[model samples]
Target chain A: MAIHALIFDVFGTLLDWHGGVAREASRLLAPVRPDIDGGAFARAWRDRYQPAMEPVRRGERAWTDLDTLHAEGLDGVLAQFGVEGLTPEIKRELVLAWHRLDAWPEVPAALTRLRGGFLLAPCSNAHVRLAIAHARRNALPWDAILGAEFARDYKPKPAVYLRAAEALGLPPGEVMMVAAHTSDLVAAAGCGLATAHIARPDENGPGTGEAAPAAPVDVAASDLADLARRLGC
Target chain B: MAIHALIFDVFGTLLDWHGGVAREASRLLAPVRPDIDGGAFARAWRDRYQPAMEPVRRGERAWTDLDTLHAEGLDGVLAQFGVEGLTPEIKRELVLAWHRLDAWPEVPAALTRLRGGFLLAPCSNAHVRLAIAHARRNALPWDAILGAEFARDYKPKPAVYLRAAEALGLPPGEVMMVAAHTSDLVAAAGCGLATAHIARPDENGPGTGEAAPAAPVDVAASDLADLARRLGC
Candidate 1:
């Protein structure tokens, strides 16, 4: 069977998380600290993402969804920046910034076209609720939400990729994992899923590293529109 | 937070599954047997649904998605109706009739309205792929797909209702189960979720059984549009 579904890595692959979060953080926190660099704060918070999930991934802690993880990590980032006296309501709103990220300009149109031919969903590290909220806000048009929470483990885990394919009743080979992150694609490929890498050059920031697949991907494109075209959508 | 999401029972609640399936069956099988009653054939096939899933629900057999169950049950229905010589391709297509079901006339508009206020999804026993197909065909606009496949268990099981709530990151009380079936509402109420009953008087063919709440529900309406109104969407 040909690839029947395409699962995406949401944060950078579908939505511009760094820019969205940074923008929100700046808007919310600028009054508190004039010296705060919102972009750096966003980077700092996201930098903790992998390490925060490591304990759960290694079985050192019980599984926790990404929303809880994001909230917990936010506290440390706030303290690190010496930003304090924020009310619980503000903190809650800030935590939800991840759920309000804007999709890349090409995403909605590309997904709409791709959806006509293949099932589209987010196979992100974000929890289901986060995925749902983000999809609603950004109009991602996912057929389903499958992610770290659904698999009860974070990405780069074989189970996450395998279980997502299983949930779609598709063999791994028939499900393509589309991600801007080379590591996600590599991990998905390891689990027998086909891979597509759509580069998001500004995912990290202007001067940061660009993702190149460590291993060959079935398709590599400049963005989701390019990916959609490459996939013959 | 008062019903953050409304999870629906898809087949009878959202789509006119019986009518749609019957119509498809009549179109596909009338050539072989002029006497074949398509509505009766649809009812007979659906009649086998619960019994087919009992083993899986009871742990007597490993989990099998509704698509496979429908296929297996179709063989018996074909034999029961004295229809034969259908190719594997034809049977496969017939089994997929469940996916191409037409939504009740009010479904799309009501869902679009409700979508503005709440996260909406089909908490059907249908597999994720089936749900995806149905949504694409009918423009159901589900925020996420959750059901038997996600829970690895069928409806009326507390696990199904509870897990759906969990996936939304909401407490059971904040998630409402909307169904045309009283039994599904009762089960959802038992799990501390609110319930809404949208009557599908023709669900089992006219005058067969009008679904009435065996227990008190949060809302009861003549149809999905009525339900949307009662829910203040």
Candidate 2:
């Protein structure tokens, strides 16, 4: 495939959301709710992420950005962990934890190399605001910020893949969806976009995420740097 | 107003489209049709630009990117100049002149410095593909591609300004709209976004564009670097 652009799954593929959210959740919540587990709070928040986007993806609700959806789901997640006593200011800071996510080590420089040959963007569920904040904090030299907000829907949906390629003025076949998730890669491949699997074995937690592609892909590598080398960047 | 992001106008503000388009059009057409003036031809194409987006801005036409509009406008421009003999491939390449346009000499480094302090993006009428291609060619350090396609309309439209602010997850007052044209900054100011005027004195031709704001703006400077320094970047 003649890939002209690489659209990434940012959360797991580029940024370590689980680790970031877990750390921040524990750091803030531990002072208030000493009995709560930071890892469990992070997982609870992430668990609600899909369900929050479900209504919008299915058109049951209007297009809502990640921060808004995250804020809307925060109370329920807090209750699930029996956490309390956090002020709205603290809660806002906690939601912004997603925006403060760090890239996997080797990602910044690797993406810089890959960018030499391909238009790089995150075709993630993250909204433009979160994406920009996250990219700036992590030093991602993306040629564009794209995906869900541009599509007005969430991932695993064909529109997300199609809209991103359209935004890049590329045919689906000329764009490659790079993700650590097998389901995400499969979804993109089904939409006729090329797929690259970047193994993020610790994305969910240690040894919890994909260690390798579970399906066919145009490129597969152990991490972002390896993926960059494989792509001849 | 606290400015968290700076959105820009592309054609005359960031890139020297007047010169670039003139050079390409003259280089290509001058060989076969020596009678046509490159300067006038470039002016003719640019004159058609506003008229082309007028229908869309007035809601008389569906959303269409600049590439399509430029391509459509090409035939009339060629006929206006009585030019002929360009192959389809040559014509396509000519249309891509917009993507290959270079930044004004001070723009690249000025934008790099500006990007250090605020989120930077093109709030131009140009679509994502056009923006990405142009930015890559010029080494523009944009955090995201915002504007037309994102708002589904051309600039000077309130949606173009407001939607761009929305995309950056900031209130209108927290974003600065940067452009050489007074009309663009005025439009942005009307939308409650802060405005910066960077004098592109030769944007239309030698000393043809604005040397200063025709109306009030939040920041007014001689050029982008001057503007950056004024903004403390």
Candidate 3:
């Protein structure tokens, strides 16, 4: 079947979740602790995101939502960073910051080009609201949004990708999964969706140095803009 | 709480499933059965879409996907039309026709505007794959793609809306639901998401005359572009 849709992994593929979180955390903590290693703190918090989903991903937990998981992970990051004197309102505000994260500069135009030829959606571990909010905030054009929430398991898991295909009403072969993380494409590949890898510098943590992402992908691009061109968008 | 996301009802809201199907049918039948009321066939076929979901929506069935329901409904419309000599391939083609339906001319622009402000996803009764495929074909920008698959239930049921919000990590009130259909918004309203209504002239049947949509939405606009403006997009 002709490729009809492109399912994207939002965090590193379209939006700069790592950079946005790093910046947002830097700003949020700056008022209290100027010495806070904003970059390190951001990475630390994000490092926990995948592991945090492990319990649910592994089926050890009865499917916790990302919001609650995010809160759990954030609480630990705060304590480890030795940040103090935060009110509940402030903490809640910080947690909601995930909703306002910025998109990479190339995303808007790239999305426009990609949409000309394919169905674009975020297939990610991000909470539905976070993904949707980010898309709205950043202007990532997607046809639908797919999340781990749909499968109750995070990406890199076959269920999530398969569920996404099921939702799109297309067989796995016709839909391609795009992500900056190779591990995500690997999972999507397992479910028969063609995979595209768009490398996001921030996601792999600076110079983990473009060591190939953990998953196997079909086409690798430098970013969304390149991915669009490769797909003939 | 800050509104983190928005979920929409697909059919009449995003794609003019009704109108598009009517137009396509007109083109197909106009050539062979010049005397056939292609418009009426279109309207009747479109009308069956929701009623077709009634079984799954009401818990009378075991949560079959929308494609199956559409097939069943398609068979009924075919029978009623007394259209003869339909092959299995033709039937399959006809049933899948819903997947290729066109969006209202206003959709792409309005969606562009709405996408500028909020996280947008669909909380529709359409199967996930169908929704995803439609978005790709139509070039909709959704952050997350949600469907009845999550809760194993259809819209009008609180579970569908609630599950979508929960997936997005937003409280029900923090998420908004947009649709051209009244009952869909009503259900979303019941779930506490802000609701917006778009007028779909072909929904009730061609020339049935567009009246005000059935319910009071937060804002009723000429179409999505108007909707985007009203939402501060």
Alpha carbon deviation, residue A83, candidate 1 (Å)? 2.9
Write down the DockQ of candidate 1: 0.82
lDDT, candidates in the order shown: 0.87, 0.90, 0.75
Give interface RMSD, per candidate: 1.1, 0.7, 2.5
For candidate 3, what's the TM-score of chain A, rounded to 2 decimals?
0.92
User: Residue-wise lDDT of candidate 3 within B109-168, one digit each (tens)?
Assistant: 778677666767778887776776677678776666675887898778899898888776
Task: Report how far residue A104 has shifted in candidate 2, in Å.
Answer: 1.1
* Window of ten residues with lowest summed lDDT in model 1 chain A: A206-215
* RMSD for each of the candidates: 1.8, 1.4, 4.0
Off by over 4 Å in 2: none
Q: Per-residue lDDT for B80-149 in model 2, tens only?
A: 8887778998899889888889899999999999988998999999999999888888989888999999
My TM-score estimates for the predictions, one after another, are 0.95, 0.97, 0.81
Candidate 3 residues lying further than 4 Å off, grouped into runs, are: A13-15, A100-107, A199-205, A213-217, A222-226, B1-18, B58-62, B96-123, B128-150, B167-170, B173-233
The sequence of per-residue lDDT tens digits that candidate 2 reaches over residues A1-233 is 68999999998899888889988987887678877777778888888888889999899988999999999899999877776788999999899888889898999999999988998899999999899888889889888888999888999999999989999999999999999999999999999999999998888778888999998888999998998889899
DockQ result, candidate 2: 0.89
> lDDT for model 2, on a 0 to 1 scale?
0.90
TM-score, predicted candidate 2 vs. hidden true structure: 0.97
Task: Tell me the native contact fraction for each prediction.
Answer: 0.97, 0.93, 0.93
Ranking by TM-score: 2, 1, 3
